[model samples]
Target: MSNTDHLTALKDKIQAVEDGSIVAITMPVNIYLQEAEDMARCARIDIAELATINVTEVQIDDLQARIGACREVQSLWVEDQHKANQAEDLWADIQVQANELKSELIHTFRYAYRKDEHLMSAIADIAEGSTNSDTIQDLNDLSVLGKGNTDALTAINFDLTKLDTAADIAVNGADALAVANGSRQRGSDTKVLRDKAYTYLKESVDDIRAAGKFLFRNEPKKLKGYTSKYWKKRNQSVKKESDVESEI
Candidate 1:
């Protein structure tokens, strides 16, 4: 399905399921889905036997559709998440550079206004806040302050073009930061949708597993097909760690 169809199905499924746990997503989505697919295949083979509990062929087809929706949504979510992460990384680097330049310009402003109390107070206003957004605004403020008092800066041998650079950095950094924040929000939104799709799928999977477990309870090999190997190993590892901690 196209991403739009996946997203639409995601919304509908999310509305259809209102009580799924948001936690215990222990394994990666890809690995968990692979195990689920294996279990689903087993369930398909034993579906006739699963008739006692009403796990019909219709349910199996529904499970497959849910899986497809999840796979497509998962891919989109991962792409958005990667973009958000990259944007955040770039923002951090840009913030560092902007802060460094801000520090330089603030120091220069202080030196240029050292003998003038009125102008020093202006410098104080420009240097008030230290947040990323505040720092970007300060760059703009400093550029204006420097240009307005170019004579004093020139007397201190300041290059005029540095003011232009400060103004440009302020505009560039603000635009980049805005884009980064928007990307992060998009990633967060997509993650919630993906979780909903997962839950919708888990409902079908667990229902089928419940039936399979009951049908194959007398046969060990058949019973194993209904279980989750990924979760079993994860639970075992957690229990082992807990045991060691208790011993300590």
Candidate 2:
């Protein structure tokens, strides 16, 4: 075939293989989704449990007791205001953690989807003979691209790690900003710390994006059959069977 014809033929083969791989990819995607959902649900349940315990209730009660002991209403009001401020601070910290977990869940889903796409593309290239066969000796080779225990597992662990790191940075940066804002209201020195925290947050976001791009890069080869050896083995088996039948 001419080069153009060969490429066209290869494309057709690739399309067929891609169709098959898409079906295979679905199983892994579902598995990853289930695992991610379970994890997110567990985290939310834990947070809810903590909230139910009403640990903050103790602090509020302590504040009330102190207020009752004060002779002046003004002094009681000041204590109450301080306690309210502390409660607000605690709530903000919880909010940051919740947001971080939400971001992590999103990252997990995206990583799983991306992994599915990569596997499908790789399988297509292999079926089309467009990739180096040596690079993908079998399905095991394809599994290495994923983060699971076996080659068949398509979990993208590396992507998850990067996302978690980014989430931590974002949560910490937001907390720092809240602190700086509160400090400013009290006429305390905080501008320098705020600037530093913001810079770190920006760097963290950039790193996350870079890591995602690296993971999403295209594979150069695909997995293919060892047709020549397979055919040779088949012929040998056939010949042996024929000789045995003749002897009979």
Candidate 3:
């Protein structure tokens, strides 16, 4: 194929892989495997065409040997895929256990103390406006992308660690507030509990924002509203400073 034709064909292949068509139990995994297979077939075809284009026998043999080496790597990838599937299954099971525990705790203790009406209300308010759900979803994304380059993955892991710590602190603070308000009236440690909750809530928000800023810093277009504007301006200023420094 001509260069333009090859480019168009590659684009078509990429689109087909990205189309999200459901041909199996899981669309993404199947699509990725199919894409790999297609690319390997294309490589074989290209090798055959090269052999027919007046290439030396030695060159063809070298190409064939390289293909064999790649096939060996592909076999190693199959082993990696099997291990990844096991890890994913284990993670799913952990999620189920965690969800069960969360449900049981809420059901068994949320309303056990009738005098904890104010405490329960505080918890509800916190839950209603919480960024914990988004934080969790981002963490899942980070985990799934863990196989990327070591430096990039390490940066993501660091941000996730910060987020996890902040989330834990917020959760612990909420639990403490709940315990404090469970027994005492408004005249007791109510203010203390409120202050604790507020401090943790603010910390959670700050940490979450920091994580998001780092996560999408390279793709400011993906950010929304104030975040998009802020990052865009920040990126432009940094670029300008770097350019001036280089000129100096």
In terms of lDDT, the best-performing candidate is 1
| Whole-model lDDT, model 1 | 0.83
Candidate 3, RMSD to the unseen true structure: 27.4
Q: Write the per-residue lDDT of candidate 3 for residues 113-203, one digit (tens) a residue.
A: 2246754564344334323342333333223332232353253343434334334443543444344333333323333322222232223
Residue 112, candidate 3: C-alpha displacement in angstroms: 1.9
lDDT of 1 by residue, 217-236 (tens): 99999899988888789899
* Number of colliding residue pairs in each model: 0, 0, 0
Model 1 segments more than 4 A misplaced: 1-7, 15-23, 235-248
Model 3 CA deviation exceeding 4 Å by range = 1-53, 125-248
Per-candidate local distance difference test: 0.83, 0.36, 0.38
Rank the candidate models, highest TM-score first: 1, 3, 2
In angstroms, give how far residue 247 of model 2 lies from its true place.
99
Assess every candidate by TM-score. Answer: 0.88, 0.20, 0.31
Query: Against the hidden true structure, what lDDT does model 3 obtain?
Result: 0.38
lDDT score of model 2? 0.36
